[model samples]
Target: MIMVFGIGDYGLYEPHEGHFAMVGQEMIFQGNWITPHLNGSPYLNKPPLLYWLIAFSTKVFGAHEFAARLPIGLAGWLGILIAWKWTRQLWGVSASRIAALMLSVTVGWFLFTHQILIDVLLSTLLLASNYFLWRVIYQPQSWVYWWAAYISLGLCLLTKGLIGIVFPLLGFLVLGLVRQDRKLIRRLRLFRGSLLVLALILPWFIAVEQANPGFWHYFVVNEHLDRLLDRRFPPDYEVSQISAFGYLIITALWCFPGILFLPSVLKFTWQEWRQGFRDRASTLERQYSDGILLLAIAAILPVIFFLPFSSRLIYYGIPAIPPYVILFGGWYSRYQTSVSEEQSDQPLAISIKQSYLPANFREKKRNKVVTIYSAIAICLGICFVSTLFFHSLIVQSLPPVINNSDTKLLMFIVPITLGLGWIISGIGIVRQSRFALLPVFLALIVTYISVVQGFIAYQDVRSSKTLIRAADSCLNIDTLWIFEGSREIGTAGAISYYLNQGQNYNAKDIAEHHDTGWEKGNSGRIYRHVMVLSDGGKNRIPPNFPGSPPAYLIDRQQLQSYWNSDRPVVFITDFLRQFNDLDDPENRNLPQGVGKPSLIINNRKLYLNAAAQKFECNF
Candidate 1:
């Protein structure tokens, strides 16, 4: 419910959200559920599961932002539940509850919950698979858990790709090597499990490959391998690649507040490591050590896996968040228990503490606890002060980040609130208060809600919905609209979605067909596809954007032809600078007869061909 709160308050963001929202909407409009379509083109970048969920959601809830995001929100909700249940099973109820609370307020998890992307759903599915696999390891006699693990893994495969299986496999491999546990390996039944996974995922792969030849190579080698090696053709994520240090910083931020307890979590892991190596260890002791070790590995593996890759996104560490919270939950639960014991009147509690921990060790433990919270408080304090004093400096430095001081301040509110929360929580922790973490969690929830509300401030800058709506009055069934740009689909997706949906343009008409040449078994002719207008004569689809397919790229000759054609053509471009050139009477860059824009809003403009003047309407 928290994740879903006010989800529809803002318009869908450009590019990412607009892309997915429209693809799912197009699935319903086109009556094609197996293949995902954007604008008029098949979007082969991702699998259809996310689109399927979005289509089903919009079907029941109507075509709107809430419905588009509802699926991911619910997925996030389920992820929280999984964290709670898994933690309870491994640790206890208190830890389980804390884990859920931690995950709900996690910066990356919460932000992605409201997004229209596949990562939240994919991460949730991956978590489910991980939990069920862990269950298989602990309860080897339970075939149900085994089957559930495979099924979830298969769904993960459908959700993203090989990483669905790769992450879990990698984590378990590291766990097995660390423990030298061949028993877990033998219990896996790799042959049968592999067959089950193949059965579940193969049919879709086969069908998609048959539908589009070379899809296997494209998806497997090009998309996966080339992407890993940073050699993807028609490169899409050149701006996304980050250094190793950048990855650490991003991961730390994603796991904020939760990361405040990192030193203790590491300390606990180290203690467990030493315990596991001890000459004398009980079954329960080994079990606890192994569980902590597994959780630690699960939490860090994704970060490690993506560290070497040049292409990375801030949200790529989402799958790691669940285990991270679980680790925090276990450590925090122990800390809370110890505090309670210290305050209790029971002689048994006093004896246990004195025997297990000497006075110096107890003092050191208390100091460590104080140090963690104090460090976080100090850091947050510094951030709050820096942001308050250097507000103008920040706004000037990142001029393109937020359009105005208000939105920049709004963005700053999150960190400010987080800083204050840490300060209060630090006091509570120093006093050994039972609810020390509550204030920070509450602040996270409240500030995130505010962040959602404040997000609308960027609607004009990030979304083209309003601009597209202004042009709606001029549009009709016969109006031809082409987004003119050479860059990746920016607001073009939002424009395409709004234009097609507002005017009741049929899916076929919106996705006006051009020869893709793939159908004639002419592999050579396949180069003449969607995006790029060939340098001289050929056509090529830039791999960067599969979001808005109905949008056609316009070259000089095509622009001149459209301008001179008797039929109505609405030339739309979001690049305001281009509109300036088009408006200049002396600017020969545009066709000779081009005049002022018929409609202009924000950074987008619409020019009416001579034939479109008859259909002109004001905003």
Candidate 2:
């Protein structure tokens, strides 16, 4: 699945992916490592840590979609490996595999890993940090473990900024408050560890500040504080606390069935945790129980920390995933024990088995029977409806896919058939054994991945790169114009990366991010290639722009410049044109829009040119 499709091949996936690609390409093009400049302006929306990783990858691989996303994909895999190893220590060898599988199937981990985003890397680092911190609490006399926690904390800071460190810090404080792990604090080596973290990140921060004055205020005050406090100038996000239901919904979508096992996780964690405080438990049992308690607290802290924030995206809930999966894996391990005829592996699982074992059929047997059959029924029901009514769903509820790329009947039919086969197999297994639930569940997830990959491939490259492909034809005409038109689905960033493969690619003309409008092209020089959107989805125009600027009026000066060009000046405008022109007419792609000038020149753009500067930017 990893090798099957290109990141840019599936469309830049709109603003988030496009932004990452653009920054990476720019980092390579400019050879400026300290300050990540985009479109000749300091693009400080995010810290340069992720950009540096991408820059290194692009430097080695030459800015391909695969190269841009390779690091995060690797990070995701590393996260799974770490989860597997750590779970083995907390649970057992079998639980380790289950924990790793849980993460692999998580929608958030899978998607974010493949896509070029900071969160995958951030999530991995946080997982490691919290894992080591727990080691610091339970496994004493380990200086290396404390260092690992602090080192990961620093890297996390570089990846997303203050929130990176803030998450672990809050989780630590929460653990200390709840578990009273005070000795762990003394062992943290605070002074040495603080210096180590600062040493790793201080050079980059200093370099950026020296290069761009007032970066501290914009980065710390605006990007960090204002964004979090919902007080940033120009207000990027609305201010309000999220309801508990919102948290539940976000976690449900992210963790899915595993999250549904929360009650079981809480029950097991609570029981083990209570035993740790009792004097009768052995040293090893107390150590294992303490680890579980720490994980539970770590999982809950992020949700509580973000509760007061007025603005939050569902992805921000990523920090909770590692702990939740660990706990879920424990429940699964315990469930396997009660059902299996073999001896349990962990002491806790042994205890659970002792309580669970009964003369006749156990409650777990009844629960397993009900749950597995109910799941099978739901799967069959959804598959039946999808296979039978796919056409109707497309006509009404669903958005149309390009090139008649509709979901095939076989796609639905084969999965449903396999599911029924599993159900039948599961029923047979339940008579003598209940371990079939594990294989059946694995088959379901593998089937899901296969189906998703098939749909992605069927969707094809043209569906995603419409505007970029449209622009591809104009390169022969020598009508060079910096992209001033927005390409939704973030084809713009993909465009910048691909189009800039030429040795003479303009740093100014290709708005690496959103257009700073400081490019020399504003002086009006006619050249080759189509230019569209350095990042201007917010600068939406009519389907027929320049001719009719109903939503966003083009500057008469820029319009005249393009019209008077010696050769045909090709530019695709009217973002709404995609509605009629593209094959996927109904797909309303999401684009990044905040902190940008509208098609009509706003006050900031005016001020930049207010100093008798000639405004010659060709849209």
Candidate 3:
């Protein structure tokens, strides 16, 4: 509930989430459950499962950010719990707890689960589907679990189109190859499961195809195959080509702190290899190792499978973490139990023969714990010092950063608290004091939450929510023709969203708007109530803003000219409130003839070409 309630103040628009919200709002407002649209034009970007969730959420919650993200957040919790249950069954209760916590705190899962992205939802379904499939394979006897696997596969298809099914199929194929079991294929109940999956998934595809003639071609050929093969696609898709290693870097980053356990992994694997695999292990121990191998396959293969592709995103790494967290949790649990015993008499080296790595490299010796805690303390001290003076650092940054005065001493509380907390925790951990460790853990959580808050504040500055709300008083939104280019989509979407009051108007609803962007049109004060353009002298003004030719180049002079006219026109552009006065080094290169804006919105400026009446209607 906390994940999806009262988010009016959290104002920021990411690339995909903006479109998702627009479609959801359109669905609620237009009552069109099929054929989603963006800016009044057909939105062919993705399937509608996520949109359905967002639409329903907005319907109940009144179209707030919380509504936009609640469904995915709920889905994330479901994924975590499923992973926890599976890990517990495979390992133990402690491993399950660690698995849940690890999944929640991993950089990728932590961030993506909170945002309105289909990837996280898809990842959850993927994990669930794979988990059930594993159950059917290893712990099987029940049709119920098989049905669950089939249902998860079908829903996965709904969540992310083809890759949903493709991922599971690939994973199953890998598992069969790893086990050298040719009979695994026949044992999977391919016919029944495939039929069940089709039964669940085909209706939407058939309906959408019938309603829109080319739905299949666009969604499959263009969205999936083209991007998969080319990595880059047409400009309409707005994707850039990425190197094969791009996603690798992202994967490592997403699994942060977890990846930091590599040395531990190497250390433990070496120790295990030195001890050699004994034939005396019990069934439960054998199952644990088997589970780890399967998880290792599931976690690592998706990353490698993506290597041939050109397109990449951090969220694509989401699928890789479930197995990763499970394996990690298993290792941590084992280490906690084993570390109390004698040290291994083996040299530390990466074992090339052992395919698996350990979560904890070495036992948590006293010296090692001290070193780790001491390093953390030093890092926190630096962060604390930086926080004390971070505002001055921000003042010299880009205009998008919020500038804090040297005197808002209250800002120091969070950093100081964190720094001191880290120091205390480090000392406690080094001394192995349980009481000190408790507050230290709490402090770590506080530090994490504080980082989230800091991220929000940093991103909030770049948000044009303030500018859009302020400009709300000066424009006739019902008839406004805001000009926005590719780079300006964030601001454009925000302005359009505010103007419509969280209602999504289709891209083709131009009778009430025009965002034709700066393509080659001329302007000579012909616009009626108000106009908002974003380039703001950054680019040569298009001769025609919403149309072609007959447009004057909009610069400081042209904006000021319109602002001074008796028949006033309001022009909105992002600007620094005190551009020349800012401590920013970029101010040294300010345009020679830049003039003042008529209205200042926080730090972003607005130049108004005012008419006798400005903002005749309230937003």
Candidate 4:
């Protein structure tokens, strides 16, 4: 219930969910599934895979917010399952359980799970591919595992482009090289695997390209290459960059309680190296080496791949979390190893036995410390979950008029949750739970939090119906046109999606499509009846514009000339307060000879052209 109930609503009000809904609606309306076109031309900002998934989902569930976000929630849930299975395969059931619990409660996973984005889907598929890849490496005879890996990789490609494949492929290759797993490499079937990957991905690429001319260049080259190399795209288009070392620190902080075991993990690993890799040695030693290596690789590889490019974002590190959690689980598993009493003649054997055994009283005390740390981690997880639930409840209870207060209050929840988690962790240092109680308690907390957060998200989505309705009213206008002056594509996309119901309208920018006869023979007759939606400020009209202004301008002089008389023109803007000072006649310095707006609407001010009243309404 938590996963699906509130999944659609949490952040649906803003640019994210609204924009996605627009794209999904367009796909349905146009009846063109292959090429996702926005405002009429080919939209190459992202891969078509996510849109295709949402379209298919909307067809099944209906075009509602919950329906749109269903796939992402499902992917997040599935990621937990895959994390469990993969970790269990590496370190046994106990570790798998711990890893799964860790992932279930992590802040990043919790927040994004309810969002209508492609990152979770990409992460889930990547995990699946990694799981299968691990199986192939461990059991080379399993051709099915190899096939599964490639298939998952292909799906991941569809989800988020090349980085999906690049991160995992590089990690796997580098790890294999480090471990000198020659047999695994020697039995490689690259031909068959490549074929499977191609078969899965090529069909969509070929079909979409054939359907939308220039689709390949814009999506693959311009979006993927040009954006990365030149940063010529819009400011919001790229991810922020962090130094490789800073990434490690942020990742460690993000991982929190799980990261607390790093020292022990390292100590355990060193013991293993001294012992010579042997099965009979301490399990703790073996686990520490394995966990650290895997976690380090997972945590570091994605950052390395994205660091070179100027773009970086918090979610870019998402793929790293699962492996890091698995490492945490492995470290937790080592606590079960029993100390050996017998002294060994062999130096390797002695090191292994000593590291594995809690031989001395001091070592036994150390074991207690480790147990307390695990307890702390569990407490932190619970606190994080509780805070999110509280914030959701508060937000849901408040009225729309209190939106600013609600937003401010909502921001406090995460930090408080983190602070509380730290306090609980501190408490765990002094108290040791009875054997088995901590794990069970932690499990309950994780499950409760996941379900609760999911529910809140559902309610959020339901509340967003009003915003959608508002956008819908604008769509009802027969002569609707969007101005590029102050309107953002993000907002425009959301409005367009809701209004157009996902149909491809070939909607054009007011300036760019001005000459296409939209305003030609119609003149003021066309302009009089048409309802223009604009940001109503300094119209920074692009140079070498293709079309005339759509009956609106930031300049009073342009308005007077266009209107043919100083009747008054209506100006629409969300930021009406910004124009307050400009409205003052004393402060208004006319540019050589220019006039100011004559009237203002709620956010929109009307400065009517006296001659405009004489023109016939075309509609």
| lDDT winner | 1
Tens digits of per-residue lDDT for model 1, 1-619: 7889878887888668888887787777767676666656666878778888888998898878889899999999999998898777655667778899999999888888887777788888888877887777767789999999899889899889998888878877877898798997777777788999999989888887777667887888877898888787756454446788888898888888688779877876566444544556544445555666667777888798888877776678877788888878867766665534434333211222121221222345467656667677766756764666776666676435355767676657866777777777777777766687887888788788777866666566667777767765655545556555423443455566665553333234434443321111112211111222222121122444323334345456876776687766666653423333433322323454768987765665667788778765766
TM-score of 2: 0.76
Which 10 successive residues of model 3 have the least lDDT summed? 518-527
Q: Compute the lDDT of residue 386 as modeled in candidate 2.
A: 56
Point out the higher-scoring one by TM-score: 1 or 2. 1
Which candidate leads in TM-score?
1
TM-score of each: 0.84, 0.76, 0.73, 0.68
Better of 1 and 3 by TM-score: 1
| Candidate 1 local Cα displacement, residue 436, angstroms | 1.2
Global lDDT scores for all candidate models = 0.69, 0.57, 0.58, 0.53
Cα miss at 389, model 3 (Å)?
7.6
Q: Which sections of candidate 3 miss by over 4 Å? A: 1-8, 231-233, 236-247, 265-287, 338-401, 405-441, 455-461, 487-493, 502-619
Candidate 3 global CA lDDT score = 0.58
Which 10-residue window of candidate 1 scores lowest in summed lDDT? 517-526
The candidate 4 region of ten consecutive residues with least summed lDDT is 520-529
Clashes of 1: 0
lDDT for each residue of candidate 2 in 1-619, tens digit (9 for 90 to 100): 4422344445454445666776776666656787764433346667887888888988888756677777888888888887887787766767787888778776667667767778778878988987887777655578789788888989998899988887777766765676576775665666777898999889988888777777777788877877777775534222123565696587567775467557767877787566666656655655666677767866787677777776565677776787788887876665554434323544343433232222222344566544664465455535544555455454354334322334444455555655564565446334434354454455556655554554455433322244444344433323333344442323334445444543353444444432322233222421122234322333332122111112122443454454454433333333323344444332222121112222221110101111111233322
lDDT, candidate 4, 1-619, per-residue tens: 3445465544354345555655665566566777664433345567777787777788888766677788778888888898887666555666567688777766557667766767778878877876777567555798788888888989888888887788777766775676576664454466777788889989988897777556676676656776567553444432234655666676665555466676765564444344325646355444334334544666667656666665555566777666667666655554542223212222222333443442332346446665566566656656656666567566667545443553544345544545454555444433432133244334434444544454453433323333434333432233223222222233344434444443323334333423321221111221111222332333222111112333322344543344453332222223212444444333232222324433321232222234332333221
